[model samples]
Target: MTKISTTQTQDMHSALTQAIRSEPSLIGGHEKSLKGDAGDGSTVVVSAEEIQLMGIAQPWDWKPDPVGQITMEKFQFCDLEPAKDSGKYFSPGGQSFSSGYRDFLALLSPDFQPQSILSAVKTTNQPPTSGASKSGWLNVLNNAGQLEQKPSYSTSESPEGWIAQVSTQNTEHKLTLEFESGDVSVATSSKEVSVPPDQVYKIQITATAWQRIQIFPGTWYNQAIITIAKARESQYLAGGMAQVAFGPGGLINSRVSEFVVAMMPSAVVTMDEQFASSQQIQASDIQQVKVGGFHFSKGSPESAAKLQPQSVFQSASAGSGKTTISASETHATHPYILAVIIQKFG
Candidate 1:
């Protein structure tokens, strides 16, 4: 029989103790150390190879493969059995796992992979309708080149304001008025005025008034003009004058004067009157004339000579007592004449 030394026996015991501590579950919690000595009076011992054969443990000191040299196999699920359809399974706490089988199948599909990060996205183009598909910054750039047809004349009113529309040969004009307290009246020419070829014109007149009488005249007046040009552009021309007196026999008056000329073939004019009088005693008069194209010069024609080119007048007045009165008046005129020459040969 061979005998082992005390030092060898101690070394073997230390190695066995370390392997047990590293993986206690492998040994199934069995006693690790020996208590009795061999018959030869030396400590009992066991070899490292013998311990491995008993399924106690295996050595883990082997070197790992070099980086990037390892190979991976394609993923597969052939070994996994299909999930059972046992109607439903409930836990002791009343939680249902009826759909657990379907969830497990979904986890194994390609849909479970993480999606790729996106950098940009585009919107889908859609056909335009009267009023639809408006969203985000899309609304700003979508309706760039569209025309809205407006009627020749239309009026729309709201609680806060009113709008009036008028159309001409090549343009449309709109007027909006807002008022707090007062009456509003609008009028337009009833007779149609013919426009020559390649020419356009627009005319608008607006008047407003407010008055309060307390034994004297307390009144306000305003007027404005709006003009639309041939190229769909608008121009405004307005001028007004107002006067008021504050005493018991005071007088208040307002006047507006306008004259326009266009170098065209024919002339057509119309006059419209609008007035509002308070109490009693009021009077107004207006006269206007429109003429076609003509030439004015002396000896050309009696009609042409009658068209006065320049005129001046003066007057003076004096009164005294209850019946004395004196007055003077003066008048002056100037005219231009044009002469033509012609020659004939026999």
Candidate 2:
């Protein structure tokens, strides 16, 4: 079984970056919900309750394995077989399989046992801080005491009262969010669509950038909404499913139902406007779409299938349909993630 060694992290990220640029179909019209990302330098520790809650709320839905089985707490990917599958990447060939978030910790460090993590784990949800904004988006202060609403798809959300919320951060309008369907023109789109986050996958990330984008603290864990602008000509970002996750423990964000605003605003993010404008994405616009949370496999789907969508967010896989070494597939289309700026941190 091939596992993702930390050494391969950079290599994998580089491969994905290049792959997406070369393959448009890989990204296309995927990435539905813009799951909030962790701001640069922001770190949120995953709690034990969150992990347990997922286990009880959403456990692994596979039946007798292709190799062995392990209860996965979060939605993780492996181009070959989604971590949920008793397939490849994990304890294969019927090797010793353990459950819980410990699986991830194990990957990070085999010596870090589940028992140790179980004891050390604690549910500590902190309140807003002096430097943070509860709004989940960037909260920049201006001379007007409020940010003027940019001409865009997102409605005018006053940053005045939100200044005291659990928060921080801000955005641009010429947004390009392509999903698996492969529509390359998100910059000019004008329609609004509601799509399941799982159904639409994203690959908007770079090796250096993804490293800095952490999961929002006590993050929504579920998917959130995204507003793209359509006013001007923006450079083509990334372009394929390779931006998603290939190996297990790859970067996976929240999962939920998102209300997409195809109203491209044609906005721009200059260094000056970085901390100046506050295009707040109201919480009302976001919700959990997947039936059993992110781990939702095909069972939740009407077809009663598994390893199809939902829980599976991958482009380069190994075992699901392909065999032997590894395989690559696409379910994305456009790129909008940043390299240095913490674009969305909810």
Which lDDT values do the candidates have, in the order given? Answer: 0.16, 0.20
Tens digit of per-residue lDDT, candidate 1, span 57-98: 111111221231111100001001112221111001122111
Give the lowest summed-lDDT range of ten residues in model 1: 337-346
Clashes of each: 0, 45
- Backbone clash tally for model 2? 45
Best by TM-score: 2
On the 0 to 100 scale, the lDDT of residue 183 in model 1 is 14
- Structural similarity to truth (TM-score) of each candidate: 0.10, 0.17
Candidate 1 wrongly placed segments (more than 4 Å):
1-252, 264-346
Off by over 4 Å in 2: 1-99, 102-119, 122-172, 176-214, 217-346
